[model samples]
Target: MNPRGTRLLAGRSLLVLFMAATAVPFLSLFTTALAPQGSTPHGISWPSHPHWHNFVDAFNAADLLPLLYSSCLIVLGVVPICLALCAAAGYGLAVLGFPGARLVFGLLLLGLTVPIESLITPLYYQMQSLGLLNTRWALILPLIGLFMPFGVFWMRTFFQSLPKELLEAASVDGAGPWAAFRRVHLPLAAPAVSSLAILLFLWTWNQFILSIAMIDDPSKRTAAGALGAFQGHYGTNVVLLSAGALLIMLPTIAVFVVFQRHFVKALLQGAVKG
Candidate 1:
């Protein structure tokens, strides 16, 4: 084979190996979840009789409805507001070029480096001072703040990559920044925004530390957050736990599968153009 063919074969082999490695754990989880209730799953072994109802049992046992509701509530609360604010911030930073903009952008960059673990303690205190702790507001408010840096960064990078001609054309037509954004840039930004929305949805759904730490009530916490307590209560039942874990993960997996093309396009376009 030629050198190019050899390299292509090597790349394909690597991709197959990578895909297999990633699929193993999920395959194991699915098999284990099908194991009989109360039976300990030993590795990836299939059960003699698969019990698909373990998911139902897990759902009922964990009282997952409230957890799901709380997760949805938080996601609904966080994603839109965060997206809007981030889009506006990104546009201002990338297009407007106001005074002190670099300083402000620098602070946003600094936010990306700060670890969540470090912020939790101070955030807890701050929330307590505001009498917001133990409520859904506790989760919603802190999460918005936590997500801002990355969200702003993502949108700003995309905005920077956008062609200036679109904005200029809008201006020549006597359009202001707001009108230009609404009419021209916003439509073009669909892919980038969708990508950001998917990420925010995934992160918000899986947010455990903040949900558990900020909210005292397990029912009020996110699905992933409430899973800790659910696990504690059902720690002995591996099958149920496995089923419940998969159930918790279903939404994120579904979202990714649905929007994967857009997600990939956004990443590639951002890397190439931004």
Candidate 2:
């Protein structure tokens, strides 16, 4: 065989192997979700007593709506606040040259190295002092603080990637720093901003430890906390558990799908072109 022919065969085999490796896990999960707990699949395997109602039944039993709402509230509050601050900080670090910029940014990276678990106690006490514990604000404020350093670093890197001459030209044309940032820089960084928001939104939504620690109230628990509420002393309801897991993932998946309008190509295009 020709050298090129051998290489083509190798690439095809590698592609198949990669696809199978990645896809099989998700396929197994979907199958498990559709199947029963311990019943043998004697005849049909698709679950004809299909337990289609399990989805709503499991979710509703979990008192999931308010938990879902609490999560939404937390993400909604955290993402925008973090984005603006991070973008501004990043822009400063990237575009505005200042003494100790590296020091400040390096410190942020340092903050990133410290896990959120390390600070939960101090954060809880701080929230207690502010009368914010067990409230959505408790979740919101900490999420913003914890997510900030990375957000700033990301936005700063994006801002740095832009041409300096653009900002200068805008300034020469009578644009102030705020105006340049808002009208010019912000528009160009829309994709980066959107991408960052997507990531932070998901992280805040899925945060389990903080939700469990901060919200001791049943009514105020986040989605992950609500899942823990589903267990019994007898045994785990695999169906209900899986269903809850699926529901929690639904909003996140929706966010990604919806934000593809503002993300995916836009972010990639900005990164590649800029």
Candidate 3:
């Protein structure tokens, strides 16, 4: 084969291998989820009886409705506030160029380096002292703080890469700073903002450690976090566990499927800008 054709064949082989590796685990999980409720799943064996009702049973058994509601509540609380704050902060750093902006960016960069695990103990005590422990606010407040570094960084990069001619034209048109940001830039930033919101939602939804650590009430914990306790109580039921896992994953998968275009666009924009 010619060099180009050889390279194309190699790429195709790699893609197929990657897809198989990714798909196999989910396929195994799906098969296991379909197995009779009480049976143990042994590595990809086809179930003699596919128990489709296992999903319903798992949902009810896990009391997943409350957990799902809690996850939604947390995501709703976190995403908008984080986006608003980050957008303003990023615009300030990138476009406005306020004094000490570089210092603030440096601090945020430092925060990104700090692992979440290291803060859990201090956060637990801090929340308790504030009497926010066990409340959804506990999760919501910290998550916003925790997510700020990346959110601000992501938005700042985008804003920095924005064509200055647009801002200049807006200013020439008698637009003030807030007017330019609100009327001109914000609409243009829709894709980046939407992508950030989706990421924050996914992160907040999958927040396990903080939910399990900070919140005492199982009813208030996120679906992923509650899964740990659920597993503890029903460890023997592999089918139910698999079903619950899939159930918890469905919302995120659905969200990505719906907004994937925006997500891809934002990523492509970022790559090109970077």
Residue-level lDDT tens digits of model 1 in 5-124: 999999999999999999999989999999988788777888888898999999999999988998999999999999999988988898887999899999999999999999999999
Residue 11 lDDT in candidate 3: 100
Q: Which stretches of candidate 2 lie over 4 Å from their true place?
A: 1-23, 37-45, 232-235, 266-274
Per-model TM-score versus the true fold: 0.96, 0.86, 0.96
Tell me the spans in candidate 3 whose CA falls farther than 4 Å from its real position. none
- Candidate 2 overall lDDT versus native: 0.78
TM-score of 2: 0.86
The 0-to-1 C-alpha lDDT of every candidate, in the order given, reads: 0.91, 0.78, 0.91
Please write out the lDDT profile of model 2 over residues 1-274, one tens digit for every residue.
Answer: 9999999999999999999987676555455456665433332246655666667776677778888887777777888899999989988888877899999999999989999999999999999999988887888888888998888877887888898998999999999888889888899998888888889988987888888778787557668665665654213566566666787778888998788776675556554332
Against the true structure, candidate 1 has what lDDT?
A: 0.91
Superior candidate under TM-score, 1 versus 2: 1
Lowest summed lDDT across 10 adjacent residues in model 1 is found at 265-274
